[model samples]
Target chain A: MSFKDILNSGKFVVTAEVGPPKGTDIKEMIHHIELLKGKVDALNVTDNQSAVMRICSMAVCRICLDHGVEPILQMTCRDRNRIGLQSDLLGASVLNIKNVLCMTGDHVLAGDHKQAKPVYDLESVQLLGVVNSLNNGKDMSGNDLRGATDFFQGAVVTPEANPLEPQLIKFEKKVKAGAKFFQSQAIYDINRFKEFMKYARRFPVKMLAGIVVLKSAGMANFINNNVPGIRVPQELIDELKAAGKEKALDTGLNIAARHIKQLKDENICDGVHIMAIGMEDKVPIIMERAGLL
Target chain B: MIITKKRELQELMENLKNYKSFFLIGCSECASLCGTGNQEAIDSLTESLKAEGKEVTGGFVPKTGCQVLGTKVELKPFKEALDKSDCILVMSCGAGTQAAVEIFEDKPVYPTNDSLFLGNMTRFQMFDERCSLCGKCILDKTGGICPVTACPKGILNGPCGGCKDGKCEVSPDIKCAWVRIYERMKRLDKLQELCDTVLEAKDWSQNIKPRTLATRPEKKEEKKK
Candidate 1:
């Protein structure tokens, strides 16, 4: 079933992140896709995830389609002006790609190429509106399109953001701009996420809680210290520490599986979006442990 | 006011290698306040150039270096010194450098300061960029806080996923611009208006560069007559 259909079907959905290789070697990416073909409802192809330069998300999405898997084209406003963004949306539609996730994207400063210019011509909310306009047979300029797009658009939110009210305000704006679903930032604290869901449920859109599998205690501490709007709780970090170096990966996967299980059993929201950054080989194991298999 | 910072002396000297002598010009307005075009700065540069074994014909700080007509009138007294120079070094913003370019068609002109952003002097020497001058203003909707300028990404509807602790993801030192706008709007009991308003895609054509404006009155009266 299409991702949109799955969301509407009210079945507990699962999506995973797939970052394109920095270079042209797609062998590992293809392998990752093959492993996750039936495991996820859709695969979100990150556009230079964490502002690091990588192969374009569109090309990878096309590859996912070739492999008989649904792809979510993640588009960011940091690298493209309005013209470039709108044209890429059209190109995605031409390639028969359906799902698009609009994001403001990390600033170029955070990336490897710190000197590159950032083009935030449109933010996430504005980009969502642009996608809605394209779907409605009109451009952002109100000009008619000979052939309009049919994208199932989504956006992102930070449920754990310290100043949660502004993020919520922007979240509602994204909803009004026609976001069908929201795949949130990495979530580690389930109770806090549940509280956020309580407020988010007021909107009609589906919420996919983001679950990033921690690789180790050190990685969790790095995220807590560096990554904004995400807090990996102390007990989880200590749990990974107790697991030792070799066992940390398994422990992390188990932790992720536990979150997914709890979220699914509690009927928290719509589903979960798992991000196993660089650990794609372990996602299936995570799913199996979560009883998803 | 437009902020400016001095270019490195070595870099300026490398650019001035071909010139045997120079006539320095400074501005008394924003540049003077910024210390880039003040009399003391000119004297220091004069000393530095002399130490480098280069001739300094003359130097002066005008009331407003960018005022083409006024600068032209003020420079008449230094015509002989100007003619003796191989180049003119403008110790002000790019506009001031261009003013010298317009005046000295024969002599080469170079700017000694890089014109930074349009900002306010928050403290004695500290400046903060407050306006991006995107042509369109949405300050009314944002309760007077400009996200376009303050937000590192300039997100219209933001406090993007990167906002943490009411601070920007780029740096903890910088408060998230959208958060400030939200707090201000809430204090004014205009959160409803903030929520109801969905800012459309910006009219980027309005921000097209090399922008020009002449605020003269329309010729309606003359045309009617």
Candidate 2:
């Protein structure tokens, strides 16, 4: 089904993120894509997420499409300029990959290779502008193109950030720049998300609050301290800590299920983007526990 | 114009360090265009020297080394190497060599290679300087062929007056620029103008003198203020 139809259906549309492998071994990625194929509305293929280089997002998306799974091609403005971006977009359109998620990626310094050069000719906002421009059959330089693209453009948002006004402002800007949907950063607090949704309802774009599967208390604490705009409250951290060593994965999945159930029950968001990181296998279990399967 | 391999750069670094206090100079113009001695190249060279147990002090400066502007600037930041070493391993074209010689006056300046003619950038890994920057630009009149630049003999009058089945006297692959120009002009229906003007000898002074550097005072003030 088309991404637009899935969103407009008004059901609790389930989505997930599947990171491609570091090398060309597509076994793990393919397994996850197939596992989540008909179970989720769409799957997002991250583009060098967290500043770590991996297999090309487009290649993974192509594999997902071949496997009968809908793919959301995540693109970051960190590594390519507008020219390369437009070229990749045109290539995606030709390849029949429809969904896209635009992001201002993590800084190069945060990656394994610190010396890599950053090509930020167009930030996320400007990238959205370029995508809109290409839809009108024109490139960033005002050069006319042979044909146009009709992509289901998506953008990212962080609702749990302190002083969430900036995110809200950027959300409005992204919607104005032709972002049809948004998938937020990991959400640990449902009330905070509800507040975000109150502001979000004024706009027309659909949103899917992020639900990252916490592997352990340590993992939750690491994200809380290291990852900006994502805060796992002390109560959840303590609960994960109390789960003991052997049941860490179970506790993590339970927390994820709880988050999803709260989001669905409260009607906080239109969908949930389950980011299990390396634990893609447990996504189905989390969905099942949340009564989404 | 001149291309230096990574191994050649390592060898040059060794030689520069062995001699006198050395300043590994880079060019921003031709070197950048050639993609051999830009900032990225300099950084790689610096890392190579560090790996080889040498404490060479050097930094990169943008602009053609042969230009007076890049030379007059303070290279003293690399003074530790310059004061202790005897030579400068300049990664620039021949123009860079002249500029380094003019700046260091007494210091020995060695060239990596002879600077060649101007060429179009084919790819990231290759560059071919095909143009000689002849005074006249007859691209519009001759469908983008400079007979003076491409022809080895700088023949502007005719195809060497010895047409051996439309091939040049220099080489078979090297199609005579005039022949190509004439054919292109004929295709474009502008062949009549090709016979109208008799070209004269080029004035060497157009490129013979040293280039002067000029900066707008307002731009400098705006940057400073």
Candidate 3:
């Protein structure tokens, strides 16, 4: 089923993300896509995720389509100017990729390409507006389009972002800029996510609580230290450490399943976006354990 | 107002190789505060040129390097020295450097300092950029912090997911500007005010090229009368 239909069905929808390979060899990436085809409502193809050079998400979206899986094209403002970005959006539409996750991607310095010029011609908030304009049969510059797009555009929110006020402000702007749905940053604290939901509930857009699988204490600590807008609760870290190296992956899966169960049973938000990172094969098992399968 | 840092002495020396004699101009405003156009800076350059066996026709600091009329009047007494000089080297921001260009249309002009940004003097000899001059001001919505200047990515609504430990992804030393704005907004109790309001796409037309503002155009008409 399409992501839009799943959202409108009033049922808890499940989605997963897959990163494109850095090199042209997509053997492993295709394997992951096939594994997730029947399980997820949609799969987000990350575009140069974390600013690291990878195969563009558009190509991977087409690959997903070929595999009979709905793909959400993740677009970032790091590599493309407004003209370039608009042109690519049109291309994605023509290719029949409907869902887009608009974002102001991570800075170039955070990725491998420190020397690459960052072309954030339009920030995420502004990119959403550009999508709105495209849907209305106009380009960002108000030029007439030969064939405009109808994209189910989405954006991300960082509820755990420090001094949450600015993030909250940007969240509302995304809604106004025509974001139909949201997928939050990796959330570990259920209580904190609930607090964030209190504010999110007032908005008209649907929200997908983001659950990042934590494989080990070191991974949790690494994400906490390096990734912004993500905080792994101390207790979860201790629990992962307690699981030891051999059982860490299984422990992390249980943690992810537990959160999905709570998020689904409690009806905290519309759905959940499971980010298993390299463990795409484990997503279906997590779904099964959470009784979603 | 604007910050400037001196170009390397090696670059300055290379530019002076063609000119046998030079005239130096400095600004007493921002340049002085930035240690670029102060009296000592001019004296140091004057001595260095003299040591290089080049004629230092004259060097004087101006009250305001950008005030063309005022600088023109201030430079009248140095006409003989300027007449002897092959080039005018301005020890101030680009605006000040261009001011000399305008006055000495006949003489070649070069800048001794690189013009930086519109900023505030954070401490002695330390300046921090505060405004990006994006033409549109959103400080009222951003709790008085200019995201256009402060954020490395210049994101309107930010502290992107890359920000770590309340610092920018570019550097550990650079505190994320959005974090500062959030704290400031929280302290001011205006955090709730932005829940519904969205800072829309900036009207970039406000920052169109060659921005001009005539503060007192009526006074010019009155003076003409």
Candidate 4:
């Protein structure tokens, strides 16, 4: 079924992320897609995540289509301006790719290309407006299009970010800008997520709780210190630290499964978006551990 | 006010090597704080030129170099020195340099400093950019902190996912501007305003080049018509 159907189906949906290879060789990337063919509802293909140059997300999404897996084309404003973004949106529409996630990507300095120029001509809210405009048979400038798209677009939010007021303000703007669904940043604190959901429940759109698997105590600490909009609790970090290096991976899987199970059991959100980073193969195991399989 | 920084002394001298004499113009405004244009800057340039066997026609620090009419009124007494100079070396910002260009139509005007941006004097000799002059102001929405100047990516909504430890992902030295705004709003006990509002995408077209504003009142003759 299409991603939209799954969203409206009133079922606990599951989605996973897929990062394209840095080079032209997509053999390994495609294998991950095949492994997740029927395990997850849709795969979000990242666009040069962290500003590191990689294979195009559009190509990987197209490959997913050919391999019988649904793809959500993750679009960021870091590399492309308004014109390039509109062209790519049309391109995605013509390819029959139904899902697109709008975001203001990471800064270029955060990636390998520190010297690269960043193009933030349109941030997440503006990108959502463009999607809504395109769906209305017009472009951002009100130019008519010969063929328009019926894209099931989504946006991202950060619930556990420090000084959460701005994120809350932007979240309301995203909904008004035509965001049909939302996928949040990595969240480890269930109470915080539930508090955020108390506000989110007022919106009509579906929200998927973001889950970044912590492979070790060091990994949890790294995200807490290095990654923004994410708060890995002290208890979780200590739990992983207690598990020695050899069993840390297993412990992480158990932790992610537990979070997923809670998010589903308590109906804190509509679905869960699992980002294993390089461990796409372990997603099915997490689902199985959470009893979703 | 506009902040400016001086170009290297070597580059300035090379451009004016052909001219034997120069009249210096300085501003008492922001250029003075930056140490680019002031009594000290003029005296140093005068000494450096004399050391290189160049003649100093004369120099003065005007109260406001960018005010064209006011500067014109101040230059009345220096016509003799201005006429003797082969070139005008302005130690103020580009706006001040252009004012010289208008006053001395026949002489070549060179700027010793580059105009940076509208900034705040955070401390002595330390300046911080606070506005982008986007032709519109949204300081009310952000509690007076500017996202355009603070964010490396200039994302209008909020902090990007790259922020870590309340610092910008681009550089740890750069504190996340949005995070600062959030804190300030919370301290003021108006956090609900931040939660309920959403800043729109910046209208870049408003910042189009060569922006002009007419803030003066119209003539009474025009008003009567």
Candidate 5:
């Protein structure tokens, strides 16, 4: 399905992630693509998540498109300058990668290498502005492009942050900057997410509340304490902890399913992003449990 | 040209309890180079701050942060924003951060990143710190490739035995500096010099570390006076 159709369908849309392989081997990628095709509305290909070197996200998206999966190509402003970013957007248009998620990306220091430099020519919001400018047939410097692009531009939002005001304000700015849709950082607390949805509903943009699968209680707590802007509530943590070692994966799936069910039941968001991290295989099962299948 | 990630705007908002109105400044030059304070980052910061319940009185002013020319133009448009602000959160390198401090002397100026050094972006979102500016350059001997700058270990005389099949031991994909020097010399047909000259160990003191270059000609003139 086209991303626009999925957005307008008014159904609880489901999207999954497909991280490009680190090397030239596309076998794992192909498997995940096949697994997610027809099962989810769209797939998001991460561009070097955590700054570790990987096969380009564009190439992986192309593979998914060939296999009949609509791909949301996640493009980051971390590595490329404005010129390169503009060129890549044009290239994505040619390749027919319909959706683009612009991000500022993790710092080079966050990756394995300690001494790497960064090229922050454009952050995510300006990139959205630049994309909007490109759509109007002008580059960021006001120079005209050979042809204009019509991309379903999207940006990220973190709803579970302690100070929820920034996410809402950025959400509004992103909408102003020409962002049509938003995929939030993982949502673990239903009440907090509902509060975020209350503020988010005022904006015109579509929101796909993120659902990250917790491998264990420890993992969820780590993301809550260590990862800024992500706060998993104590109840969810206790639920995962009670599941024990053998049933951890089952507990994670159940938690994800419950979150999706609540979001769909409450009409909290336009869509949902199921991020299983390395557990891509379990996503289909979670979707089935959520009755999204 | 140190590269850094600002604590996410949401996190920055929580930390900023006292500040009400603030100036959100970004660099148009080197901070852009290091991938920190550019227009894109500034916009994100602006959106993020506005969402956090603080009034963002300032907008983005892309400046060189190093030279006065860009700073001068930026100061005019940003003056009102600066005056309205309780603090200035600079999204630039140390030079740009200090420039903001000097320009807005009375206002509180905060650095978004710990300014590291001039570096080049490498493959896979990685940034390699290549340039050290050791005061003296010896590109003449190495066929335009400096072993000291390029090599991870900083070995000057020859390739260490750790080099395996032309790749540095430190990073497999990264080429050995000596291998690159050899190829460059070979391309220039200076390969025969490898046998004739036994180069001495580099004098450690000659390349004495912390080197600074003054770009402000007026400052140099004042020093001369």
Candidate 6:
């Protein structure tokens, strides 16, 4: 079934992220696709995730289609201007890769190429508007297109952001921009997320709580220190530390699984978008542990 | 005001290697306040060039280096020095460097400073950019806060998923532009307005490079004819 259909079916939608390799070697990526094909509703191919250079997400999305898996093409405004972004959207549509997650991408300074120019010609809200425009058979300039796209557009939100008012304002803007679905930034505090949902439930859109599996207490600490808009609670860190070195990975998976199960059981939101970064192989384990399989 | 940072002497030397004698030009406006094109800066460069065994023909700080006609008139006294020089080093913004280029057709001109941004000097030797000159102004709608310059990503509808503790993801020292806008709007009792409005895609054609504008009434009258 199409991702749109799955989202409309009221079933708990599961989406996982897959980062393309830095080099042309696709064996590892294909292996990931093979492992994750039927497990999740669709695989979101990241666009140079974390601003690190990688193979294009469009190509990986096309590859997923060939392997009988739905693909959500993640596009960032950090690298492409409106022209490039619109052109890529048309290209993705032609490739039959419809699901798109618009984001204002990480800064170029955050990436490997610190000196590279950051092209944020369109931010997430504007990009979502652009996607809606394309789907309606026009470009950003209101010019006609030879053929329009039929894209299931998605955007991102940060429920855990400090000074939550700004994020809430932008979130409402994203919804108005024609974002059909939203995959949020990583979430750890369920109660805080529930509080955000109290406001978000008013919108006529689907929300997916983002889940990033923790590998260790050190990794959790690093995320708390470095990652923006995300704070892993001290309790989770203590739990990971207590799990011991060898079993921490399993502990991390359990934490992710527990979050998913709660989100699903409580109908907190529509679904979950798991970002098992660099640990795509462990996603299936998380799903199975969550009773999703 | 235009913010400028002086280029490294070693790098400037590479550009000036082929030239023997040099004439320097400085701006008494923004560059002076920036300490990049003041009289003291010119004297320091003169000493450095003399130490490097290169001849300093002469130099002057113009009232406004970007005013082509006035700068040309002001530079008349330096004709002999300019004639003797192989290069002209402009110690101001890019506009000042281009002024030197326009004034001296034969001599190779180089900038001694990098024009960083249009900004205000918030403190002694401290500057903050408050405008991006994006051609269109949305300050009235944004409670007078310009996100195009304040936000590193120039996101119109932000803070984008990277804001933490009201600080920007790019730097903890920098406050999120949207948060500031939110606060300003709230203070003005325009929070509901802020929430109700959704900014459309920016008309970047207005920001197209090499942009030119003439605000003179004479030009408008001539165009009307």
Please provide, for model 4 over B17-128, each residue's C-alpha lDDT reduced to its tens digit, 9 standing for 90 to 100.
8999999999999899888899999999999989988999999999999999999899889999999999999999999999999988899999998899888999887888
Per-residue CA lDDT of model 3 for B109-188, tens digit only, reads 99999998998998898999998888878888888988778887888775676666678878888888888887887798
TM-score for the A-chain in each candidate structure: 0.98, 0.96, 0.98, 0.98, 0.97, 0.98
**DockQ value for model 5:** 0.02
lDDT value, residue A61 of candidate 3 = 98
Comparing 3 and 4 by DockQ, which wins? 4
lDDT of each: 0.92, 0.74, 0.89, 0.89, 0.76, 0.92
Docking class of 6: medium
TM-scores computed on chain B for all candidates: 0.93, 0.68, 0.95, 0.94, 0.77, 0.95
Checking candidate 4 for backbone clashes, the offending pairs are none
The DockQ for candidate 3, computed on C-alphas, is 0.46
Q: Give candidate 6's whole-model lDDT.
A: 0.92
Clashing pairs in 3: none
What DockQ, between 0 and 1, does each candidate earn? 0.82, 0.02, 0.46, 0.49, 0.02, 0.78
* Model 1 / residue A174 / CA error / Å: 0.3
Displacement of residue A105 (Cα, Å) in model 6 is 0.8
lDDT of 5 by residue, A1-293 (tens): 58778797786789999998788888887998999889999999999887787889999889999999999999987688778999999999899888999876765656765477666556666678878888899987778888898888998887765434323444555677789998988888888788878878888888998988988899987876567566788888888889898998799899899889889988989989988888899999999898788
TM-score of each: 0.96, 0.62, 0.88, 0.87, 0.59, 0.95
Clashes per candidate, residues 3 or more apart or on different chains = 0, 12, 0, 0, 7, 0
Q: Assess candidate 6 and give its TM-score to the true structure.
A: 0.95
Q: Can you tell me the CAPRI class of model 2? A: incorrect
* Superior by DockQ: candidate 4 or candidate 5: 4
